[model samples]
Target: MLAAAVAFLFLMQSAPAALRSATAEPRVVTPRGDLAADERATIELFRNARDSVVFITTRQRVADFWTRNVYTVPRGGGSGFVWDEAGHIVTNFHVIEGASEATIQLADGRQASARLVGVSPQHDLAVLRIGGAGFAIPRRVPIGTSRDLQVGQNVFAIGNPFGLDWTLTKGIVSALDRSLPNESGPDIRHLIQTDAAINPGNSGGPLLDSAGRLIGVNTAIYSPSGASAGIGFAVPVDTVMRVVPQLIATGRYARPALGIDSDDEINDSLKRTFGVDGVFVLRVEPGSGAERAGLKAAARTVRGVVPGDVVVALAGKPVSRFGDLQARLDDYRIGEAVELTLLRAGERRKITVALGAGTE
Candidate 1:
């Protein structure tokens, strides 16, 4: 038996190499066909929009409590996009709200210091300028109209989500004219809602259309886990188109106002008292547009509780909340005469009032 086993081993050792090992040959490659049209379109969209998107890093000034020394520390970062050929960057106001300084990284691996140009906290938008000697010009994103956007249309979001630089996420426009609560001021109005996987670092990034045109600025997400839960919001480009140009021109954006003083809490109280829903006029600014238009304020007279003019509509659109009034005012520019439907003495009256500079 031992002699027979030795003979078998000797025969196996002399066998062919293919029989001794599993690595005989490589498998045949399966060729992949050309990319689908949609895939190609997505790739082209990212390619065209890549140069316009920028990664922003910010630092915050921190003070030593014991030593009383102030120094800067890395605060946070988000995304932004080039607005024009002049190196103007448009981003969310919350991105650089308390930032001491910021740096912008371009697509070509170049970094430059950014200076705040202007900001509209109410709109959650800010404009920054970055240019010095030898700074290369950035490609401005093609602007698209958000007012004409339709639900379920293909939308692309280019941002640096979770510190992943220049990441592209695609989804459809889940909805439009959405409003999100903003800590800075009034609720952000006319936001374009999408399911584009926008995360923490996606804020201020450009939300592009299928044609690679900028339609919105990615702002916030509706997530409880601090991650993208398939719901994201962006400031519509129509508001961007109006606010960015004004931010570039002026150091501050002056929102158009009716020049009437009103409060939400007080308005709620008035609503309970008067049993009506609208912006309750508490006080009208002297010599202002509302005053010139004969808008009256609530007064405590000897006759009893004299009700004020309750603004109910703007340009025929019903407005029920103070935020609604502010949001509606955003649709028109200052100095433009807009029709306001007021509820006075339980009767509806329409008045044309020229918008004045906002005092917010």
Candidate 2:
């Protein structure tokens, strides 16, 4: 009886301490201060630009032969931004390349149908207009010139990366004047390169300067694994500013053209055979500016095939390759006169040709 009484007394002494230990709370550490100055600026930039950035989804019509029915299937999607108070949205051309329809999701989670306004495939940019009523259009993005942008300057990208809406990435301009080929048009030139973590769904989004002004349109990235590899290219805003107006007006951007078709392979062969470096004028389109300027085409004579006028320069800019000619002509506008230096036989001649609109 005496031992039982001592055991009960020990249990009574330890029971309260055991219960206290079982219900104890853990301590947690958290950030306690406000953001830094630059951090706050970045946050504010995203806040101002979020409404302008938008999410795009595309649909294509697929026909079922056996059922004799047509269905609209989900195709692909990317990003875009508000271009004006008129409700125009700007995005990459490839985003809606073959789509029959598109849907736009706004920052406020409202959805609307979008119609293709115009597209400049050469620059890989497209404009869309939102349809339906009662939906408020977001504020347009502030435009900035790429000509004054310098390497190492801070840049930002806002897009729906992987369908995650309103994501913002920050980085610096890595380079300028980068070139990339378009699938359906002329090579895209004068591109702005950055390392802003642009990914597949980031295409057609806006690349902004530190002031939250749109500097470029994010289009392509350099990656072997089909993901961003730190090198991403955007169509410069100067080109966008020039092309978008034309698209909005005419539903197409007419590139300035000389209207001469040159064979790059033949030009290379001619360079080796004739010991000259110039684009070989294989054929000149009839009624074109080149033909009007008396640009001759390669002809087959009785003795042998003879080379025609090889374009050597355009307005004092050396035209060593066929792409160089296109790049130089792009700097001009339709009906603008540009001096062309050509080599015929062994003599060089200068002629002025009025630029024409490219059929592309």
Candidate 3:
């Protein structure tokens, strides 16, 4: 009975292993299959979109150490897209930064010198006009509203990354209504974030929707490696639509400004010292709205008068940072009246200030 029981236990273990092996199917290799519907659609859009995109190169004079002479050098490069039939191509201002010369390279291997007709550093936008006629620049991509973009919607990006021309990448919208710093402005607000691959030279290129509409301008990406790590940002189409028209019409963007020029930034130290949470007024411009409204700049006894107005709120919206003021002004036109909450003489007061044209 002991021998029979030991044999039965061995059979149970061996039988299960044998049965498992018998049931396991052999690996089979198959040929590569066709792309799925979404992939095919992406490919089609890329083909159509590639024609509209172009590579921009800017040249600057650099001193050559070896030759001990100054010469023109390729300063930098970025992407651009056809804007209109008048030969206007739109790109980022930073793309052409320090550019003594600008040129556009088309997908068909046609290179042409371009003229910088307009540049708005405040908006990071520029317009380049191609020389010579008869080149049918691709259609002005239909602009889609970015205000309705929901998180996780698929997004597509095409640009010349690292000078590698015409690259396509896909991802989803990671966020919206983001704020970031700009070279010309205090901060760029209401930016759109995506996981699409945006890298160097991708700036100023179009970020498109699934239907191939121009959604935003691929501007920046968040990556330490300087490569796309599933985090990218873009300037929304609404801003583009708003800025480009004036840029093309006039050679520069003229934003309405608040006549009063005061410090826009406020920090914790400032909050504790000043006992306020709104923007700390550095100085109220003479003959400006703040001055006209009897606004006084904050003063310190030891500092011998560092006088400026601290902005606490604008039209009921709290102003914690200077960017808040800039953003609020961006939404309004010139000659608009806005209510302000000012902290003067360690006391809070409400005042009205009329916005005027910004410095040209």
Candidate 4:
């Protein structure tokens, strides 16, 4: 062993250049040809859709109890996209729910102050506007319809998940028409479920189809540890198209209603009392469209105060709960007449009622 070590040392000293040449050279570089068609498509999609995404940072003003002085503290943020060239940015309502101010970080690394345009907490959507007039977007996210989306369709999500800006994740549509509730908002129905890796900062980001078109807004993830669980939900773009214009115009979603009053809890109680299923109508607005349409509410009869007209369906769509009915009504607008199927005295009848304004 000693002789071998001495010989190796002597060889290193005698032929150090040969040893250095053997050890210092790197492996030859291999030539990788052009990317596959699917890979090229994915790259093209990311390049085209990236500019439409933005990173949002929010701040909240807090007052010190001892000095009574207010200070702005950094609040958590989420992702959004450019709604128009007018500098209107759209994000999840919960992202800036209690924020006093927010900052918009564009894809080109330019920061701009933003103002809240409006919010729809029920839908979990909010809009912000930059003070730029006729701002032109270098790239626009192609809007696509979500009503025809099917399970197992390729979907892409671009966002700033975990504060990592402009991150892209790919997955398939895990499900459709999914309904889930947020702790801060009402039950959101007709959601598009994807297996995409959506985390906290990914909220309000666009969920695009294979053609690089906006299909849904990445909103919530079904995670117990507040991280990605492969089950993420997004608000459908169809709902977005309906709610955003109203929000931009009126600062709130003027959801169409029928002017009739009812409650889910009351409906449940009435279901037991009257031995039927559906939303029980408590009262119809006096001289309203519902009353004019001959809609009846629970009233006093010779036997007792029995259930009146219980809504079973709307416009050929079955409505089993109050939220179901609420979600169905969102598809219509004010003054639009829709067929309402009701259960009157254990008999079924359909009536065409013009919807009035409703509060979701």
Candidate 5:
């Protein structure tokens, strides 16, 4: 056995040099600081997407301690981006709200005066126009389809959080179709939630995908101390696309409406009295589609409480909440007709109501 082992060791020592070289090639390793494919993709996306980001500044006059009118120092600042070559810049309504003047700070550090082109306080989005030379508008991000967004899919956000301009953050889709409040009282719907770090100045910035397409507009963050707490919300690009074009053309988003105000507040007593789920008919506008369709409202007479027609559906769609009605109605253009399902006099009836221009 000893003689056989010695012969085997001698043979191993005499192995071919080409065999050893081939084995060493298999151990050829990359450098330690090399980035993974995903990390490379992220860096590339940020580089490509940062150019579209912009900084917003607004100025307003305020009375000093002397109560004299003076030029107030610039205070309001946020993030926005170019929406088109027409000089329409999209940002949060809160960013430049109550400002006398506005400016757009381009990624190249050139500041240009901008005008409030249009605003939709209901959706918390605003459009500004910078009509001058020497200000090269960045590429407007093409709107991507957000309806197919899946959880765990990567997303990127570029904003000027905490006055830090063009800060890029990446994360996965945390949630979707969330509901958040706006100036119109929670009328904004179809929000996109992300765990990405969205800070104060991040509002009105773009939320991009791996392909760097605009998927949403960073709007709000859920935080106890006004800083990012791992939860953030963005206005879906679909909604922004639907409103921005109209805003560019007319400086306002003209959505269709039923021209009637329904009782949005639902109490136990009201629900029990109406024998329906948390909805009541408070009033119907005269000469409106609701009135033309013979829709009645609850009356307060000397007798017991009377219930009017209960709207269970609109346009063959169930409306369990007031915001649902608003969300559905927002999809329709002005002057479009819609059908409504009403329960009146213990009988269900369907009526077609032509939508009118929204007063908003």
Candidate 6:
């Protein structure tokens, strides 16, 4: 009993010490005077860019069958940035697609009704205008050219991802000249690939450089889970600068057109059969630039369709496929004249065609 009592007392005495050591307070270090230079720069960049970024919400009109009443239903939400001091907002075309109405929410929580100004489905870009007595235009982002952008350079993306407003993500430019497919037209070329965490709601936000200049517009991401997987593509600002002005002025982007239709599958099959290496012109629209330039289209005969003028090159650039021709045309203006090298029958012919505006 004496030994048991002594042991119990010894255990009781050591328990408090063990508890004190286990629950000891962690050492707190005093914070420095301010953030580091790079940290300060990043914070300032976000502060300046946030005001330019806006949240976009859209709605669709739905009619009830029983009551015959029309109601507005919430469609979706995305992000955009101010294009200019005139209250022009730029966003992805897919965001406003099929939306009957849209609203723009500024960083200050001010909301206004937005009207669709124009859309370029080929580039997946759209412009919206907000104007009223209470509508106050936010600061516009400083535009930067993507032509001089270097891979691995630091970039910042400010957007509303998953409805989270004004979220900023930092990353580096992963690549340049990346291409993404467009549903309405040819591929969107010269995309800026980055590691920025761009999500669905970030579709139309500006991708800024280290200097807080708009370098690109965040568009899509390559992810299996429908979230950011470190691979995001942005439409380069050079293309944006070229298209937005035209859109704002004319309410549409007039792509230089050849007015010829070529089936890719058929063209590929014909190329393989003939052992040729050019885009086969399947059909030419009457009164088109192609038709006026004396370009002939493939004709259906007794055995099979006979191949017509195969587009070999454009403006001294070799066109291996239909997309190549479209991409080449993107570089030229609608009224510009281009030389098309064609392979017809057994000879190569050069023809000049003044480009015409393409219809969406």
Q: Write the per-residue lDDT of candidate 6 for residues 20-136, one digit (tens) a residue.
A: 555668799987897899999999999989999999999999999999999999999899999997889999999999999999999998999999999998888999999767566
Global local distance difference test of model 4: 0.88
- RMSD of candidates 1 onward, in order: 5.4, 6.5, 7.7, 4.8, 9.9, 4.3
lDDT of 5 by residue, 4-120 (tens): 999999988898976565443456786788889989988988887787889998888777768676776786888998888878899988898899898788887788888888888
After superposing candidate 2, which stretches have Cα over 4 Å from the reference? 1-25, 28-31, 265-276, 300-305
Candidate 1, which ten residues in sequence have the lowest lDDT sum? Answer: 179-188
lDDT of each: 0.90, 0.89, 0.81, 0.88, 0.82, 0.90
Which one is best on TM-score? 6
Residue pairs with backbone atoms closer than 3 Å in model 2 (clashes): none
Candidate 5 Cα deviation (angstroms), residue 56 = 1.3
Report model 6's TM-score to 2 decimal places: 0.89
What C-alpha lDDT, on a 0 to 100 scale, does residue 319 get in candidate 5? 68
- 208-306: candidate 2 lDDT, tens digit per residue: 999999999999999998887899999999999999998888899889999888766667888998899998898899999999999999887897669
How many clashes would you count in candidate 3? 6
Tell me the tens digit of each residue's lDDT in model 1 across 1-360.
999999999999999987877656888999999999999999999999999999999999999999999999999999999998889999999899899999999999999999999999888899999987777878899999988999999999999998999999999999999886654456679999999899999999999999999999999999889999999999999999888888899878888888887777778887898899888888898878998999999898887667889998888888777876876787788999999999998899999999999844
Cα RMSD, model 4:
4.8
lDDT of 2: 0.89
Candidate 6: residue 219 lDDT (0-100): 93
* Model 4 per-residue lDDT tens digits across residues 112-143: 88999999988999999875655555455789
Clashing pairs in 6: none
Candidate 4 — which residues are off by over 4 angstroms?
Answer: 1-24, 133-138, 182-187, 298-306, 345-348
